[model samples]
Target: MTSVLDAKTLRKEAAEARQMADAISNQQDKDFWLGIAEGWLELAQAWRSGGAPRSTKLKEDSAIGSLCLGT
Candidate 1:
């Protein structure tokens, strides 16, 4: 239950970071927010999987990755 709550909180934070990225006019600033969002999402996934977060490598096909890569 606590883990579920933690994952939810992390997901919420990820959403907020994405929103911040959306509001940024500078590409670098937007990328920074997107990176933060990616980290939060990775943390949420790790919490759900009962493990520590790993791998900062961005998924080439992910939405965040697409944005970060400008694809």
Candidate 2:
């Protein structure tokens, strides 16, 4: 399925990822979540600035797909 996310939604997801990272005890897991949050925030900023490319079908193995799918 194709999903088009707005900047607001992306920022919300970023915040949620950051909160999850804060609750993690493992350094590796925390870092992973923080990275995801950063990616989401960047994407949101790009969207707000109209620099983000149009949404396309994401491969299941892609990093962005994993982030968006919460896999």
Q: Looking at model 1, which ten-residue stretch has the lowest summed lDDT?
A: 59-68
CA deviation > 4 Å runs, candidate 2? 1-3, 53-71
Model 2: per-residue Cα lDDT over 1-71, one tens digit each? 12778888888888999999999999998987887777777778788988953444233564566755677
- In terms of lDDT, model 2 sits at 0.75
In model 2, the worst 10-residue window by lDDT is 53-62
lDDT of 1 by residue, 1-71 (tens): 23455888889989999999999999999998998798779878988999966855556665555654688
lDDT of model 1, residue 51: 90
lDDT score of residue 48 within candidate 1? 92
The most accurate candidate by lDDT is 1
Per-candidate TM-scores read: 0.70, 0.70
